[model samples]
Target: MGKAAIRIGTAMAALALAATGAPAVAGPQDAGGRAAPKTVAPLMGPRGVDALGHGRTLVTETGGTFSLVVERKHKPARVVPLGNLPTDFPPAISKGPHGTIYLLTGASGPPPEQRPSVLRGAAAPAPATTLFKWKRGWPAPKVVADISAYQKTDPDPWDQEGFPADSNPFGVLALDDGTVLVSDAAGNDLLRVWPKKGRIRTVARLMPRTVPVPAGLPDVPPPMGPLPPAGTPIVSEAVATSVTVGADGYWYVGELRGFPATPGTSQVWRIRPGSTNATCDPAHPRKGACKRYADGFTSITDLAAGPKGIYVLELSKKSWFAFEMGLPGAEEGGLFLVRDRGAMPRVRELAAGRLKNPGGVDVSDHVYVAGPLFGPGALLRLR
Candidate 1:
């Protein structure tokens, strides 16, 4: 919900699979991928999407807005606005029971102070970021979660790339029990927020602690040559970008491999339901704990569960932070499909070359995707 859904921060992360069934998982090239051959309309920084039965869909316009697009038989589609964000930045969205809509925004991304260089001529920052909830036909939303108080920090938290530490909540899901799960990419952890309870707590650590890029570069996406001089963290400790509930009743998580643009390093991890302090250990996973659900992907940004399978969207194999750190990457951005649910879930690439920098995804009457996010992106209907 967070990273890919809004991509408010500089990068995105994602991956998901059913824990139910499938044979050997195969890369798109090996699985006879489906070619994407349709364009619906232009979407500005679409970071997330959800579909309500009967042809109605919600697409997030990254910078603080959700376009409620409705299509009918032989009718032109309609788009409506649905957010009151503090700043003009990308945010995340999710649909709950009984026509309920949930919107989440955090106080992160390029702060107003850095706009002179980072944003150049972008909109000014809002006073703060918060979560809003609404039921169908409700003219006003109820402010449920206050992430602003969590934004109060000393000396400011900056990442290895020297960017302001962000509370940019990317992925967000509204559980049936009235609890909300949010992935704070800036915080590199998952948060369990009880809106009604007025409580919040850490759920899991998307990536283990940052590690030094040992000799030979072990798992930093091949052919990157040797490591470069320092300016940022070589290993992406953790950017808990997205989260979803697998059919197995487990919480699946995704993360972005830090700088150096490690292609295969970014992973979608599996976490136990109601699990707290989940340790997503990619190197040496512990049984009954968080481990790699799917690897060999690049910058996975979002995921959506469909009748057929789980849809995965990757922003880019290349790294934005790496490019900033003088370590450019060869990006292969696009959409992918994950089937089965057991440990060895199957995977297939659908349209990567065409769907550049996809931010989020969802399934309904058809599959919907948004890309080139970060700003002025486009939305496509891939059936």
Candidate 2:
């Protein structure tokens, strides 16, 4: 969920969670009395969308514009100019104070354009990792946080993916408590920017799972066909990606468990009051404090707290990688709900096979979701 944000009914929750592999949820007609339409008209490269303060929808796109799109058809869009700002496309959005919009961005660079490493071998040049606060009356949007300045990456790590400055702050939230929550997907941590306190806290740290080389053959064709390489650590990284402060008054962070996607490895964490960076440990996850709230999401893209509870937007393991690499699978995207809190918080699917690589979701009147994101991806109302 660059992302989204609930749950209840224990035995019932468990039963619904068990339906994870079932087809997407279907219901009666939508507003305007339409048959649960498959998808809204497609937009361009989408990074995130959130239900605005006015109950309208705000969508972030890469072509240097942040737009407010009314969910209904024939409504004209209002564009916010991002002049030399947000660096790249804002990867996520959240509601802010007094009609303000918080745009969370990835480390500056063009949103991953999927340039084949075989060609453009150099890692794309990184930019000023930052968060922007946008609203009317300001000469320009304010850079609320210089995200890279706050990141303290692994002093020493085995992965050769370069340095700590590679922080991609994906999801963002501006809480009523005067704190800002940002998820650093590349850095693998949830950060709290306390402006007045003059401190940035690593509230939750997500560890990268080491998927050891199978003692068998490889799944994809090794470029070096004759000499098969040794067990390659599938370390694309499923670090902390999305975050939201739930209606329950606690904060939640979601993961996009790196490559070789472990079925149930991706998770959502609950952060309680008074919990510090060191306390919310996956090593010793404590229930209602820093515990895993939900599991088994394919690739948790964004999180939204809305009418149907907390909805998990899966980027769909297959389709996401299809453009990133060339691996193919069902590649179907979906939306799931966090069934309950406490340990092993269950998640149940609500919509499936309709989304592609959804990056952001805004839960409001119609439960609007955007993307299977790539090339201005489409928006759809969950039926």
Candidate 3:
């Protein structure tokens, strides 16, 4: 919370030439504002590879290595290297239903203590299995029936709140039957493992509880410099990043909250399944069930649901915010699509190339999207 408030949450939003559909010029627009006219949906991966269909795709390379994109139709089809992780580890890859591939690793460190480790690959490279582990503070889960033994221990014991070792296990999912969801933007929580029988759980814990800044909606800008002694905990107000699990099962959590230098404003929460504890005060006494469904978003990182519905990915300008899931708390829900902008024009067309620090995204039959590549460390894919 002090590196200039974590670089204004992650900084990277200052290029607005606007072009696509044209017609959004008020102020800060990037997370997908212009750039329309899109219809590239033939579906073809593995030619320089970026395919995330039913086959493979488990990229998470800040340098930690989790690369494995195999789908060769012509060129790019070889990156297999699923091992080394823990330098800036924020991997989240999921593709389960036969080919089975799940690699959820997030460890900015701290909490009960375990930190990050949950790798599993069913095909090529094979050897990468950790399952579960998290110590410093505890109580971080969103779904879990079992996860091999949860690495052995440190499930929560009775959290104390102090682990900020680095915290950054961004998102990971592999449902269909395998069941493994992990998202820990600094241990704000959301881990559920059940890889067979081992069992290990935390289910959900995105903090919440800060709500009160909604008078006119523009006041939080004052610390552009030195701040972080008051109470600390400013990892962009419980970071959270991205976590998807929706064909209807319900479990979409994406909170960037002032990232990459005030991208514009970020927020996205929707946890169904039972709803009660996201981390404290459901009525207190212990709390832990899960609640909070919708909220205005502006900086949401990545989240994709198939069937052609919920797809939210806003990396500070490269935009996307489509929704349509109502019935539980149904507040007149049913918007089919809000910012289609031509289905996805590389999120704002960013000079025609698009996607810079994208992150992670997964939509059933098509639409894949990855991140992490300032230069050589590739993982920049789009479907």
Candidate 4:
């Protein structure tokens, strides 16, 4: 799978199985009614989350299920299973305008070789990566866009692969006018999909990121090859993972820098609404329709914008590569709020070292993060 397999929900099970001696804890829950954080729902491999008003939240799991989490002040939270997708890695979901809900599925394929053989050739009944739409009282979600078909016709221009036809729709943002924006982690581009017309188009292409190989890296073993010496400049894929509309109305997208997965190398880019063919290159950030918003993040898996600011979710504090390798100091994830502070963007850690492999985040009355990311996770309410 190499670069194509560096997706969020792909190798989680294998990585978990390999790290047998790692500690198993839910991390710390915060302290008061207004200042404490608590788990609102118990889920397995929770990957996507979005807030629905009146103490309701929509969460998706890597196991292909999605549910509505309802919380009451005096009672325990209730998780109501709504429906399940055909693909296992339904990584993203969002509540759009007028109570409409949009769900996105990641790349579909056989299970990783490390997993059980029974799961490898399991039959999939639908397209690999698709956009689905649903609303209250709907029996099931309706297919709104065929993302994989679109990629077949229009491949990634800057893909490092010999065959550029890869599409993993990881992030989704539903607009007020019924248009949705999707970030393809494998395609390395932002796409615009019109639900009403069943049309999809490339909105922008994320440029490659140059990450410096950090020192003291662990040695590789077996099927994985050896790495170069430290200080090598590795040109990594942008791995466009999440998208959101800012409070200021600009479109913000975040990246999970590929390969080597250097810590603090991931970035968030700001693009003008309705931009076409824009570039999100960190090198020439301010020169195009897409510009750098805030950076110095490690393995950003999701981005959610609210009145406060853009909430960024990092899968691991050290980096995704380190976490995949089960390195020390990589198990604890982080949540941050990025907002404009005078002339610069200020990133403040909301739950520093308090989350374990958190993958999804959203802001409603307060910030919410979904965790353990790989297996048996929960939806946490942060204050």
Best by lDDT: 4
Candidate 1 deviant stretches above 4 angstroms: 1-37, 108-129, 137-140, 148-166, 209-233, 322-332, 341-343
Q: Candidate 3: TM-score?
A: 0.28
Q: Give lDDT per model, in order.
A: 0.58, 0.57, 0.41, 0.78
Q: What is the lDDT of residue 215 in candidate 1?
A: 26
Clash numbers, per candidate = 20, 22, 53, 1
C-alpha displacement of 90 in model 4, angstroms?
0.7
Q: Write the per-residue lDDT of candidate 2 for residues 1-383, one digit (tens) a residue.
A: 11111001011123223434332223344334545534554566566777764436677765435666644446544343332243445577776667776766565343345322331111122345667776655545566766777764432132225554456777888787767788887676778877554367777666555543322333454542332244555444546778876777777888876544444557777777546663334445564357766666656778888644688877764423232333344345667887564545566666544555566776776677776454535556665
- Please give the RMSD of candidate 3 to the true structure: 18.9
Q: Provide C-alpha RMSD values for all models, in order.
A: 8.6, 9.5, 18.9, 3.6
Better of 1 and 2 by TM-score: 1
Residue 282 lDDT, candidate 3, scale 0-100: 22
lDDT of the structure predicted as candidate 1: 0.58
Best by TM-score: 4
lDDT of 3 by residue, 1-383 (tens): 21111232223111111112222111233235644212222111101112366646555554344556665665556666644443333345555566555554343212322423543421121112233322222322112222223323433322233333333445666667666676555545566666666454666665433322221122234554333333333334435656776666878777655322233335445565544334522224123445444444444556776664566655434221110111121111111122223423122222122443344455545565543212222333332
TM-score of 4: 0.90
- lDDT for model 3, on a 0 to 1 scale? 0.41
